[model samples]
Target: MRLTSLFFFFISIVVFPQKTIKTSFVKKTKLKAESIVSVTKSSNYTSLKYIDNQTLFLKLNDSIIYNYSNVQLGDITSFDAFSPLKIKLFYRDFNTVVVLDNRLAETDKVDFNVVKPYKNVSHVSTGFGNKLWVFNQDSQQLELYNYKTNQVSAKSLPIQSNLIDLKSSYSSCWLLTESYLYKYDSYGSLIYKIKNENYTTIALDYHDNILLKSANNLFYLTDYNQTIAPIEIPKLLIKQFLVTRGSLYIYDNEFLHEYQLIKD
Candidate 1:
């Protein structure tokens, strides 16, 4: 009877659902764009691709350097930054990628036309693997361009995946399609794919783990099993998601909320 009672108790505990706590945490110092610095808009039509604490580099037909202390990045088609010290800017019309040093000095210019012989240079997406992954429209394969040596290598994929959107954090790469989240390692090899099932918004941390915002719930992807760790964000429409270090920051309307990752 004792063993039977113990067995039932264990089963009951296992069957019961775990409680999710919504504990409040102290907020971090919020840095406002208007408070920290000012912007000198260069072109009437300007698009910003990336920003850090110190500089704002813009890409038009040509790359424009802005002192984050005073100017704003404008009319950018694409951009990739290795650090605050190193960056790569893509100018679509000229089919070029410009490398910049810490002081926003031109380091080198990469012309895709001469580099990848048979590939159409219309669209480009930068990867963190020290190589630029090019979608070759002519060959219908993904080509890796070595920016340092100016060498090109091609790999044949099973499907004709369009290079719709791209972003790199640390050694991980993210290629976003209309309905899929493609994860690639530092070597440009495909690692994982997370399908968008009602995914309204998404953000990637430096490690490439996805933070998915669907409906009113937040899920974190880490383990190979794809176990979801749900989080409670405020009841508002999320405008943007930015993850840096271990802090996940969400910009909703005029307010920003920061959450710290707790690993049990």
Candidate 2:
């Protein structure tokens, strides 16, 4: 009987986690755009890809706002505003990374196509210590690139799967491929690898918790653990989702709904 009970306990934890997500019914605001390409939130700003993918609009502290558009660079693949002072805008089609200031002014640009020892960069994210996390699709590696010195300081072994999404903090980075989710330290060392079940998006919450989305469904995966719990919420058309400071911001076609995620 003791062994049977222990087995059942283990099964309960692995198969029937009781964690849930409550919306908390927060405020909802309409975006100031007809179409939104993407959405991301930072400590003090909310960014939206507006007016055809070329324009980026950012609202700061709920009052100050700024806008930037680059017609020559074409559409922006993504942007990183973790540090409002040093923003990164990636134009994958042009193989360029545009650095912007807090006021959305262009400060610098890195064209991988013309850089010596050319790199076919597919993704770029802010890294610690004046660096950028670059994913080379051709080489299939994550490189810690020193943008100032124009050198790769560290890199991981070639990844076998194609990268779907990537999110990084000050000292760590997470890479999501079609088959696995990989975590690595700042030195480009693989910390762990776990199988993925078709998660299309990954974001860090206010507490730096991992949030994932797959096919209109949201889930949470704990750090360095295999447990994944569903984040339950009221059904809505999810065009994009952003998690910031314990708040879940869901964007539909016109409205941006804000909800506090209450963990039960």
Q: In model 1, where do residues sit more than 4 Å from their true spots?
A: 1-74, 118-130, 137-140, 153-158, 161-164, 169-171, 186-188, 198-202, 213-218, 253-256
Clashing pairs in 1: 46-75, 47-74, 47-75
Candidate topping lDDT: 2
Tens-digit lDDT string for candidate 2 (47-96) = 55444447766654465377888889987888777666788889999999
* Counted clashes in each candidate structure: 3, 0
Residue 160 displacement (Å), model 1: 4.0
Global lDDT scores for all candidate models: 0.55, 0.80
- Backbone clashes (count) for model 1: 3
lDDT of 1 by residue, 1-264 (tens): 999999998898668743342424435323332111111123464222334443454433235444422223233345555353456666666567666665567767777667635346544555544567665567754556677866665453633444455555555555655577676665657877767555555565544566766766776766364545566566655556555555666655454566666655
